[model samples]
Target: MINATILSMFSLSGLNDMTTKHRVTLFSFTLLCYCVILLVNSALIVTITLEEKLHEPMYIFLCNLCINSLYGTAAFYPKFLSDLLSNSHVISYTGCLLQVFVIYSYAATDFSILALMAYDRYVAICRPLEYHSVMTKHRVIWLVCFSRLVSLLCQAIVMIMTSKLELCGSHIEKLYCENWSILKLSCSSITINNIVGFIVIFFYFGHDLFIVCSYVQLVKSALKSREGRKKFTQTCLPHLLCLLNVTTALLFDLMYTRYGSASVPQSVKNFMAIQFLILPPLLNPIIYGLKLTQVRNSVLRLCRCRKQVKGLG
Candidate 1:
């Protein structure tokens, strides 16, 4: 009875007034931003991978982050683009299921990468003497693989558990497929799915936030030594800003959805949507590159080299 009531309340609360023009405009802009983010992140990843100078643990984590961002974009943007291009925003049952899985998978992967990056920074700053042995290339590879595996397994379990519930309708009112949106579609009770989704969110977002904060604090404390202070601040500031932006965006999203008035203005939702979707990925590379002189120079040199190569080849 409690579960049924919750589902009823959720169904009643979900917005169903998405207009074609609004969706087309919003999705077009999202796609454009997505394209730019993809290009920039991919360029960074490629430059890092190709340039022998960037083979350190930090750049390796960045390359993994780039891949995770692409994974996330792949999971959602195709459907978003299709929804805009076609008048029908209806995704087939299979497609929706796939979207849910991949979206969560990439989300989990991203959290793990960020956490690992925090740890990488902690080691690089806090234990410079031990950094080389602690963060070997082999260890980094294994860590990434382990992170991917954990994320994939978690997403798989969540997807499988949620798949047991039957979707009764085709009206998903949100911009894209989300776990809650699918749950709202279920004719049956969704308590289990909601609980599982909460758990997943807690671990992915909540725990990651905890770990990043703790690691960053450790990095800051360890930077008091004269030798490590400058390098530590130089590296930590950009990541700290990135984390702050991401955390703020995520926290606002949660609060708005959970506690904000039911009749939140469409304008507010649109602002939140842009903040949540377009901003983090867009800013990540810029922040990361700007913080690191080496990365900044590398990007400039790579651009110049590319132009010259284009001119020659």
Candidate 2:
């Protein structure tokens, strides 16, 4: 039988190897990264919200994506910054679970939103005539809400199950709290947790497969005309790239968490641990903002408007 007393805190061992001399540099870089993520994502969200031309289904989805990025990073960056400047890297039990919920849910919603984007492109390119009727404003709002709700519910179940476990220890090897890392600490059998975890994984993997199939259809339709090809390159390509980036980042973290070798350098492991949080949030907005003509033009127009206002003042 496991002990009745639950652990109140966990020590994150990922930062144990860092020397004092390197801590300041690491902290500075991380802070700058977080600031940039905030600035770019906020800019995109504001631009999309304010630009009447960007009120369509695609840009609305992009705005939600940026919002998710901010939501996920908010859970990590502040705590991480504080930990970096402090000597100890400890998180409360409740706080740990909350982090798991926010970060993983953020990831799940990312995939969900990407899947929606794929379908949006599929309809836009493959069925252009029906695009307006199909992706109506009401439908777009519902889809966005569905993506976020599904992710939150799934992650909530995972967090609740994890909360019930009787942990054997409080030492987590990763830089941040994660569901799998916490499960590893359980003293009792986690058969139910494992089953539920697999179900969640399978559900999200199905989402990825759906995205792939949508893109396949998109590719087939795009090949039929030069205009279709241009549309796919301008819109679908950025979504594909963002999808690839997030998937690769998640895969690195999964491999490291599940089958990582102790022989690997701690620095490499740390990079793997935080890459998802770093890359997607920082790069996704930039990719869409620069690559998508609509977004680029809207952003430039907003800038010009602000510049003219400043000149008048």
Candidate RMSDs in order:
4.2, 1.1
What lDDT score is found at residue 187 in candidate 1? Answer: 77
**lDDT scores for all predictions?**
0.72, 0.93
Q: How well is each residue in 1-313 modelled by candidate 1, as lDDT tens digits?
A: 3232222211111223557677678777878888898888888888887888998988888888777777777766676676566654565566767876886686577678778888888887777789999999799999999999998898888778766775566565555656666766677877887787778778878756666676767767665777677776687777777677666776676566545675877657646643645556678777888888878888889999989999998
**Residue pairs in steric clash, candidate 2?**
none
Candidate 2 C-alpha RMSD relative to the actual structure: 1.1
Model 1 poorest 10 in a row by lDDT: 5-14
Per residue, candidate 2 scores C-alpha lDDT tens digits across 1-313 of: 6654578999998889998889999999999999999999999999999989899999999999999999999999999999989899999999999999999999999999999999999999999999999999999999999999999999999999899888888989988998899998888888899899889988987888999999889999999999999999999989999999999998899777888898999889999999999999999999999999999999999999999999999
**Which sections of candidate 2 miss by over 4 Å?**
1-4
Which candidate leads the pack in lDDT?
2
* TM-score, model 1 to reference: 0.86
- For model 2 the TM-score comes to 0.98
